[model samples]
Target: MALMIISSVVATPSGNKDISVAIEEMERANYFTFVMLINMVPPNLFQGNVTFLMPSDRSLSRTMVPAQNSVMDLLLRHSIPSPLLFDHLLHLPTNSMLPTSNPDLMLKVSNRGRRSLFLGNVKIVSPNICTHGYSVRCHGIDGVISIEKPGLASPITCPRVASAAAPLPLLAPPSPSPSPSSAPASDPPHGAAYETSGGVRPQMELALTTWMAFVWLLYSKAKLCV
Candidate 1:
């Protein structure tokens, strides 16, 4: 893949004449960028001449594509699925928009004449850049048709943007009361010393474990227990 030189029309379907020379014809007229992409494509895949609704260097540059494989997809999107020429365009009426190779994209033709050709909102600069056999009418447009810019999104391919996090699910919590249970009223062995008899201890019913301990101590003391 030279990425620059288009070899022959032998790569074209139906054994069309070598349009590579015609591509040069276009290049001489300063319409090289669009034609060059056509040349980069292998002959087997690229069949015949079709009207190329070309975006100018300015239009192509405006596209913020990653410097990688995505460029290939962008190229395919610009090329129409079928072979069509300017003559074909003349027959089409106003507001006639044709679908391109890409499902998202569509080529629109309006205001067609010997003076100019309009694709979508773009003005076609070079009519019949390579119109010998099939045709490669290169048009110079103001901007490229961005199909996947806003709509196309996949689970994996789309970016993990900073979207507002979903509200968390409410959860159930435990009660504040400790386990309500009574303990046996019995004193510990003689050696054990307990703090009591003077006044009532604080109603320290907090965690389950603390509540249990309070109950056990209260049982050990006979009256005024804890």
Candidate 2:
């Protein structure tokens, strides 16, 4: 049996316009290739708000399409889960990573001056292509969004602080106390000539000896006269 490929979009439980309306809008904007690719997926798979980035029909034909299992990834790479207009996109700062329907895919934004803006490798050529509905938004891009492997981490280097050497212990030399030999001599008490080692006073001994001599000479003179 031949493979039967069917594409249709149904309304979500929230009563929003079906995603098919946005696909039709892409069809009107000369993005028939992208519309067909979306049509290949079952409508039941789509839910919530979606923003589709559609390249020109020529760009799609020139680029190779992915395998059946990878087509969903292709669509996810080009689509953001939220509806954003060109003005909204312009407000996004440079290097802002916008999440997509698929958790693994993220669209990096590069904002240049004026109307120059980029989403991943694709450049927004036409802005606000789908603004009629609330659930989906579409815009024209210059090229297809590139699909690359994830999980590669950026390199980081930690800075080292300057270490100071520990301070050496300070040693102060001790000073010596003053000795008696180094001290100046003080004057003795008045009337005392000097101090003797035997502790006797020389002035008292001289007075006693002079008295005895006087007495002896007197006695001798008297005896001789008698």
Candidate 3:
């Protein structure tokens, strides 16, 4: 329960000239406790294009204050609904994720360049400290922003759609050639099941010539009834 320093007066809204010149460039960069937590919220939550990410003031004097209804979810988890700057956050490339303004928090970056950037676990340490506000920007981190717990970050993977190769089991067409005098066989083990058994060997030789003409019409009607 420490952060309640107020006094820079920022009630904004004179048609919010970019959040009043980004709260006068975050009070000339002293970042007075993140400009008193952005004057305790409201001003259309810093209207439109944001990008604050403040923190410093010795990293909000060692954290733990946000209460008045969580100060607009602690300035929407230290803003960033777009107006980025520090060279547009140096083309965000390290695991890049960003999207804060609290929609379930995000900001993953970490770029590792300009004196070592970073985001989720803080570190910016005063980048473009609110570039003369063309929609408001800010920067200056080095602590505070730690909310990242969507199952402890780092898991975007998504590119595994190669599963369509299982249709090769239709080989059951070779059971009729067993009647050539009832049993002269043992040579059918070549390759690919005997090359697919010659496509059903002419329908198994027309079903063995109609089963030998119905067994010679029952042996010519038992030799003409004997």
Question: Top lDDT: which candidate number?
Answer: 3
Give the C-alpha miss distance for residue 177 in model 3, angstroms. 34
For candidate 2, lDDT tens digit of each residue in 1-226? 1233222233323313547677677778888888888877766556647788888889889877768556676787778878788888888899767776777667777889546897777789898888777677889999877755232111222322122223233333223334446344674332123364322345445545765665565565555445
TM-score of each model, in listed order: 0.48, 0.58, 0.25
Write model 3 residue lDDT over 1-226, tens digit each, in one string: 1333332223332327877777787888778777777778776666747788877788678767758667678778888887878987888898678788777767778787889888777778778776776667778877777664442145444332233223233446755533344343664533233456465655566667766775575566556445
Clashes of 3: 1
TM-score of 2: 0.58
Model 1 bad stretches (over 4 Å)? 1-19, 39-43, 112-116, 135-137, 148-226
Error of 3 at 135 (Å): 31
Angstrom error at residue 220, model 1: 98
lDDT, residue 220, model 2 = 59
Worst 10 residues of 1 by lDDT: 152-161
> Which prediction has more favorable TM-score, 1 or 3?
1
